[model samples]
Target: MSTFQYLLGICVAVVTFVIVIEMLRRRRLRERHAAWWLVAGALAIVVSVFPQLLDTAAGALGFDVPINLVFFVSLFVLFLVALQHSSELTELEAHNRAIVERLMVLELKLEHQLNEESQ
Candidate 1:
């Protein structure tokens, strides 16, 4: 990469890292969710600082182009994040269902008691 490209990469990576930290400090992002972002930012910084590392990795992984490897990894990370969200959503739905069922039961008992009291 040219000098300009290197500087741009480093700047972008640093900005991304800083943004993630700022979000964390402001409580906009939870620690658990930020884990992947932090890792990604760190990796980006490392790769930006040492572009050769990405080339070596791409070569080892049989990728003809280093950028292609970056794209693949990014997609993989996104897929994992989506899968994690789906799992959490399923668990939350289960909990919500249980709470709703308990609420209905409680309402029925209260209504029965009110009817008996009136009679």
Candidate 2:
């Protein structure tokens, strides 16, 4: 890689890492959500610092092009993050439904008591 390319990669990776940390500090991103990003950022930094590692990994993994390997890893990480969020959304929906049902039952009982008292 050219010196400019190497420096650019390092800068970008460092920026990503710093952004994740800033988000966490601001409470905009929960630690659970940030975990994957942090991992990705760290990996990016490592790869940026040692570009040869990418070539070696790609060769070992049977990828003809190192860039393709980077693309694949990025997609896989995104897929995992999406799957995790989907799972959490399903759980939250279940909890929300239960809470709504409980609230409805409580409201019914309260209404019944009020009717009896009035009568």
Candidate 3:
């Protein structure tokens, strides 16, 4: 095996190990999410071990030049993360508005009671 291939395999292994550790620590990655990452990592490991897969995939995709698919996949994952954050922000905003409305109603009632007593 060439030194380049050996180095690629080591990098893939290290990334996969770190991902697994993070998923375990967070405990938020459901089976479906884990499955996707596992499949991606496995494919990467396989391709790194056998560099021929890169040529095959490039040919199948009709690209004369080799492209790194990982970049596209990472971008998609980042978009998903942003979407989830937006949804959470929306929910929090709605909850805060409801609380403010309730507080205003209580303040108005208290002021009316005080005025009636003074009169």
TM-score leader: 2
Q: How would you order the candidates by lDDT, starting with the best?
A: 2, 1, 3
Runs off by more than 4 Å, candidate 2: none
Instruction: State the lDDT of candidate 2 residue by residue for 23-114, as single tens digits.
Output: 99999999999999999999999999999999999999999999999999999999999999999999999999999999999999999999
Writing each residue's lDDT as its tens digit, candidate 3 over 1-119 gives: 68986787869766995686588579967554465466667766777776777778777876675555545655776677677668878999999999999999999999999999999
lDDT of 3 at 116: 100
**Candidate 3, TM-score vs. the true structure?**
0.55
**What is every candidate's alpha-carbon RMSD to the true fold?**
0.9, 0.6, 4.3
RMSD of 3: 4.3
Report the number of backbone clashes for model 3. Answer: 0
Question: Better model by lDDT, 1 or 3?
Answer: 1
Report the poorest 10 consecutive residues by lDDT, candidate 2.
1-10
TM-scores for every predicted model: 0.96, 0.98, 0.55
